[model samples]
Target chain A: MTNMALYKREMKGSIKLLVIFSAVITLYVSIIIGMYDPELMKTLDGFVEAMPELMASVGMKADAATLLGFMVSYLYGFILLIFPMLFCILRGNALIAKYVDKGSMALLTAAPVKRRTIAFTQMKVLVSGILLLILYSTILEFICAESGFPGELDITSLIMLNGGLLCLHLFIGSICFLSSCLFSDTKYSIGFGAGIPILMYVLQMLANVGGDAETAKYFTFFTLFHPDGIIAGESQAAVSSLILLAGAIILYALGIIIFDRKDLHL
Target chain B: MSIIKVERLVRDYGGGKGVFDVSFHVDQGEAFGFLGPNGAGKTTTIRHLMGFLKPASGECSINGLDCWRERDKVQANLGYIPGEISFFEDLSGTEFLKFIAEYRKIGIQNRREELLERFELDPRNKIKKMSKGMKQKLGIVAAFMHDPDILILDEPTSGLDPLMQNRFIDLIAEEKKHGKTILMSSHMFEEVERTCDRIGIIRKGRMVAVDAAASLRERHTRSYTVTLESESAAEAFAIDFNGMRKGLKVTVTTKQSLEEIFMNYYGGEKHDEHGAV
Candidate 1:
């Protein structure tokens, strides 16, 4: 059984952040929907023909002028990746490292619960916030599409895209949370928590730089969730899902192990 | 039985900066004051007792449970106030108190409300907006609201106003009467003298001395100047009392004073100067 008091406090503290993140994603989806003018896809096709390298540099497909491809490049490609990843990195740090650095965690650790219990409850809150963010964005995307661009979206692809994103962010959050649990100093926690994720993003970007760069994809977690393949119904869900689940599990386990045994030095 | 027991605890942070072979005990219903200069291992020893630090050697226990391994069970009967108080700044004072209460699982808030009123703390203000003294008051309320049997307070009156400090002294006295075990670390000699049954002084990560409060007070000697009738009378009075005679005045000092012993024990500057010489 979990601690209800801790759960409630964690929820209350992060609810405002949760709302803001969800709003950004939803608003972004709506704006992208507004960009659709039915014939704009043809215009995009012409523009892509004019400068193939411009679209290719950002990993946008030259032929993706349909609703699904437009959403993939404009919405998922940048906004979803940057905002949610930043949210997870920052919130994950705040949950553990910030408390320890500010000495507020000393009060919580002095309570009757074991340190692992506190760490576990905070981890759950992080996961719950990510899940809720994805849920709200997915729902709003559906609503925005139906109202503004009815019959434009492919339902399966939309679900697949959100599902893949959910897995990816969980993987990101777990790594950040683990670093937070391992170090009592915020500098060390942030150095690893934010540092590693940004590195992975860069590796993925460099892998997309046209030629021999594609080999770098193998070194990044981004290769696990392929957006282009996901939209084309060519994604290997079992393999990607397993990697994400395993990464999340191992990282969270490491966090609990370290937090439970390590001295907080309060 | 001892409510808190620390035995030969050693935590070496290197550069001679950690507690070394420290040992002490606090019995139930006794007030023990821990006195020290800054970085005298007082906080480290207390952290060991609070189960916040895992000792490099030796161990600490509370109510017969190991402090580090059995912290969850040990904390049930303990109340603690750290040297520096930090709260969730976004929450109001009332919200923070309520959060502590819920964590403590107290169905009735009779004691909580009583402490709030006693401290005159308006709990509606956000924690970030509260002054240092008010924040210290909030820490006091949260620690005592649980009404635990043992209290570990570090520099508990540091930021308090004079009146509030007196009120806090009175509160400690009341708790002592109710058979509470308290281990308080402080720099205020007056407060320590007023409330503690025993005192321990630490210097440079080591305990210098521990003695009963009454005995220590008795050991502390003060020189008195007595104006005699004349120089001859002053000399005669000095002979009678074995005092120092200076014209019409005679001076006498108590022997084997605790303050003298304590001062000598924490003489780091003297040690450094001697080394220099």
Candidate 2:
């Protein structure tokens, strides 16, 4: 189904990008976890009360007494979403569109491998990069929580949150991958690959504002990821995560199909 | 039997572009040269053979396997050098070759080393830093290293120096001698003349001429005027040349070079200044 040599080459090419993103996410995760305090929440609540609408728009919550709640409210909303989305966009475009655009794809297709195999292998590289990123953050978050505030974080909910985060990004990553497969030119690939996710993020922001704008959530896939809901033990969280996982699988399969069938100028 | 075959292959890119009803075949152990200008659909037809494209109207096959449907089987023992050479730029030339070897699942490194020496390519420098000729040499090495039976090269010597070009011509000749079937698209007439058994000239996506190289060379005809010592001598000279005799001057027709034969197919002598092909 996939070519291992091609997979390894792609991994080597993007490992640096994976490391840099993971490092930055680790830094933000630790700082946010380290800042968890009962008193600070009261002060932040006072600030949140002062500008409730503005606070809601950015997804910052006031009542974060529990460690998991504090982490979800602080990190999941903006920091986790933005960084991994950026990683997906860049990595996805680099995988297929860049190769085809630069004409190096000729080398890959020139071999005995099937186009389906090449696309599948590249899709694996993308999925693996996204998995490793979320996995690294999960491990780092566990380490930071255990060392700083012993037994403060709920182990299961934290795992659930990260799992949901992984699905969300996988879904996002597939969108970028599909765009990459759809266009042979990097310009158009980056345009749609970067554009669609950024639009969804904007819609998520507008929905977070919580007013007449709350209806906007229905339009964006980001609404399926509920870090706060997952921590609160909501059944909706499990359903949404499954939906996101399914979406990722479907998009990836579609990308492989399109790549196998489409004419490559390379 | 035909090892590579195309039958009425048509791929329409709209607005008077793309190959139209192009058909040709290379028999077992035969060397076929595809000649055309830059936009004459030479690369387009070759791309179809490599299975990077699907023909809209007709079918092409290799070893009785459909080029598009059974491409993996067809390409398994095929070697190809694309018109434009672009590699993983960050990798050293040696690293690129190794990756190709691994992808092709080649166990022996002897042929790769031999080709590296034959092409005089160091391949220690990064591909991005390598000169154009070096990159072209690298492409050639990669294509031939696998020891595939069928070779499809598109303008294989585009960036090589004169010396390297001759070396490449020799390589093709040797490969042909080894009974390897080859279909090479080239602009260099001398290279084709030396390597290919037959030549196909395409113009604006149409094959204008396809014949044995010897026959094409026989078609190389030009006229020359001879000033004889006397009218009687001129008349005698005109009889052999199939030309006219007028007093002391006789207009004689004779055979020209293969290059001129190609030029005649590409629409007459206005393009005399652009003579490299």
Best by DockQ: 1
The A-chain TM-scores of all the candidates are 0.91, 0.97
**Candidate 2 iRMSD, 1 decimal:** 0.8
Q: Which runs in model 1 stand beyond 4 Å of their true positions? A: A36-38, A46-54, A231-237, B223-262, B266-277
lDDT of 2 at B92: 98
Residue B148 displacement in candidate 1 (angstroms): 0.5
What lDDT does candidate 1 reach at residue B71? 95
lDDT for each residue of candidate 2 in A34-56, tens digit (9 for 90 to 100):
87877777877887899887777
How many steric overlaps does candidate 2 have? Answer: 0
Reference-based lDDT, each prediction? 0.82, 0.88
**lDDT for residue B241 in candidate 2, whole number 0-100:** 68
Clashing pairs in 2: none
Native-contact fraction for each model? 0.83, 0.81
